[model samples]
Target chain A: MAEINLTINTQLAREILTGFIQSEITRVGFSRAVVGLSGGIDSALSCVLAAQALGPENVLAVRMPYKASSRDSLDHAQLLIDQLGVQSKTIEVTDMVEPLIQLDPDMSKVRKGNLMARARMIVLYDQSEAFKGLVVGTSNKTEILLGYSTMFGDSASAINPIGDLYKTQVRQLSRALNIPAPIVDKPPSADLWAGQTDEDELGFTYEEADKLLYLLVDQRYMPQEAIEAGFDERFVNTVVARVRRFQFKRMLPPIAKISNRTIGYDFLYLRDWGT
Target chain B: MRLQLALAQINTKLGDVQANLDKHLGLIDKAKKQKTDLLVFPELSLTGYVLQDLVSYVAHRPTEEDPVFKPLLAASHDLDLVVGFVDEDSRHRFFIASAYLSGGKVLHVHHKVYLPTYGLFDEGRFFAWGDSVKAFDTRFGRMGMLICEDFWHASPPYLLWLDGADIMLFSSASPGRGLGDNEKLESARWVERINMAYASMFTSFVAHANRVGYEDGLHFWGGTTVFDPNGEELAHGPYNEEALTYAELDLNQLRRTRARLPLLRDERTGLVRSELDRILSRG
Candidate 1:
């Protein structure tokens, strides 16, 4: 039962994240950001940070709700938009995903959910061009580690402000940033269907997942060591398996080495190369 | 005698040598206006820190004939300067190096001895390791220069102290990482603590100049600081921003502090040399 201290100084985190968003975006000659505000804590925290980095007017918070999305989601998103005074746009993604979803009658709910998530990505990228802003990501570390996110769907973005934060830390930062109570306090969900909560689907609370993942990932604990530290052996194995299985989603597609200077193999340069 | 020192905490453009050189010239001009006796910039200030493949493209020789050093040498006619750059040897091997220019002459050049190879650092892959650690004479007295990771180990600064360096100039492109309940970043707190410890242990002035900016994803926190021989912080730059922080070091304090502490006088170099020789021979 070795407890991991995942607590961060909210003020310091806020400064670093805001500075990160601003520097990453502007260094590439972008003055604005487009964030998919899902009315969840992760996206809300990201949107707040983007608005703080690039001014409120510079942040374009897009709400792309599917037909099955709860009214609370839309309302909570609107609450943040109004509070931050940032520009907002609503694009209903029902028409976009429904046609493809109807193509295969036996399409699993998981497939349907991924389609919806990706449909939002298309809309956000399109708006990024029209609005002259980069796409800001909202995927938190807890879900990212557990392979809970759809690759290139909710995960694709030009810059991510909170990708390193755990879901619990996201909630902590949201509260510190004075995010609306309903958004911060509500159960986490992807809202791909009528009633879908993230924890209920994942079979574990974010607090439990975050604590375990912190030990296994950040602290670099072995699975056997984690089990000895009071985490259930089955839980440790399951989490480790998920992390291992989803490793591909965390990185760029590997390129085969052919030449003496192969991109990503031997020809290495930072993304800020020559800037 | 007092030394007017300026820590030019700046954000360098990655791989753009000309742009960064222009920045250095501008900072030198400003430091001259302030009557600063010496100005120190962060490690790789002339070329950004995260240069993976761009290392050779931006490497320069610190000579009067070198294009990059020509203007910097001309600027040094007014005020002394400590600038970091990628130094290319005659054999074309590159190094993470810093040069001390005074009176229109390159006084000393220190290639970073310890190229941090693991955990977010790839200096070993790109640059050749520097072999020597020697202090040189300046108008202010004897001074030593160490790049980012060089001062992290105890030996570099210890060697500088033994070589009669009364002032230690440390430059870093130190990225900010690890946050805790403390207000300061984990990297920042540790660096400041070590700098102060070095100053107190060696009874010498220690000035650290760390850059600020985000390159790729790494953020270089800029809390450049100066500590007197008594380990008291004299000046501190703002965190995560660019600024030219200044501190007036009363060089006489080195003599006064050493008079009371007497650690330098009591140092046993012969005993340490014999012990190190014995340990090496056993291996």
Candidate 2:
């Protein structure tokens, strides 16, 4: 782990994923892959890569629809199954999740959202146990950056193929892979609540917002420059505000810097421990 | 010749090569307007750092006629340009690098030797570590170039000094969050102290340029600065602005100071590398 000399790129990424699958399968003695297909581009691209890297017979796509999920989402889930020809099943969360919600109907939206995300993960893991497969991830770089997705829910995965692709890039890759163009272009959502869309909840479009983000956050433009660059002053302020506000989600839990090289402090890099 | 240098602290989008090129071009025009002698930019200024796989496209040493180097060539017909980029090498693995251009010819290209991979950085993933330590004879002086993290390591700078570098340039894309007001000030002091140590040791003018922007969720806290041979701050840019600052460097002052101090003349280069290598190996 000492000074690994180089870092992440596409070739290294592919090699790492391919090598990881090979090693994980041999080391853990698991041969199949299971994924929660949300009829979203992230999961679709994951299945395509997993089925190709692993085998189609070895990949299982689980369509876990909730009570509030759009009917078209379910139909699109079927479209992905037909397009990829991977083994899949319809696991309605109505029976499972509703019981917990009924038991705790007074839970806040944040708690409920976390519960739904973890619930989907539980379903994926159970299916993995039933099918003896690894749970492939559907989270992409865009969601990961904003900390928009649930931590243990959609955030946890055995391995993530699309986690590196931006949401727009995911759509691009989806089209190239011949995934349903509608699903690729469709507005993203977790379908955790009724009439929910990611943008509506995020309060900004990914394309426009990411461009502004690239300016304010990435370009180190002061709030003034971002506002001057034709970005909505209010939107720029809000996004920049949120980005600074949630820097914690991107970092490890805060630790007391008691030691010379403390975790989350000076020992941020593995080089501290490496030769 | 005393050259006016503009450290164009640019914001580059990952994978948008043409757009990044245009941005660099715009900044070049800005530098051109300033009538700068050298338009220096941050490391990987053309393409934002923390890219996933696009470096593979830049992995090959495209012929000198490649379209990528066109803008810097045209940016100023006569002004010297020092820009940082991902240059493809023979192995098809890119290198973290700085290219100096003037008179329509790339004068010198310095590839980074230390590829940092731990923590949030993954420089080791895309770049092949460069082994050569060279001091290119520029029109200004015998200048040595280092990429980000190179100055942090001792080997390259010691080698550069031994190779007779009269001036050194380090380019960086350092990410910092706005959360740390206390820690930020402390780290800036640390950088200043470290660079001061380098300046004092080498007794040469040191120029450090860091990008000011965010990319892939990482923010570059640019406090680009220069120092005289006596560890004296010559000029420092604002912490978070895309700015250009110049310092009057009297090479004769450094020469007289070094001669009076007799530090460089008495350097013991013979035993340094071997001893350091032994210590590194033991660790």
The most accurate candidate by DockQ is 1
- Write down the TM-score for model 1: 0.99
iRMS per model in Å:
0.7, 17.8
Give a tens-digit lDDT track for model 2, residues B124-191: 86578988889988777788889878888887887888888888888888765322114343345666
Q: Residue A213, candidate 1: how far off, in angstroms?
A: 1.4
The 10-residue segment with the lowest total lDDT in model 2 chain B: B177-186
| Native-referenced Cα lDDT, model 2 | 0.72
RMSD of each: 0.9, 17.8
Task: Say which docking band candidate 2 falls in.
Answer: incorrect
Model 2 error, position A68 (Å): 22
- Alpha-carbon shift of residue A197 in model 1 (angstroms): 1.1
True contacts kept of each: 0.90, 0.00
Q: Highest lDDT, which number?
A: 1
Which ranges in model 2 have alpha carbons more than 4 Å from their true place? A1-275, B58-63, B177-187, B271-283
DockQ of each: 0.89, 0.02
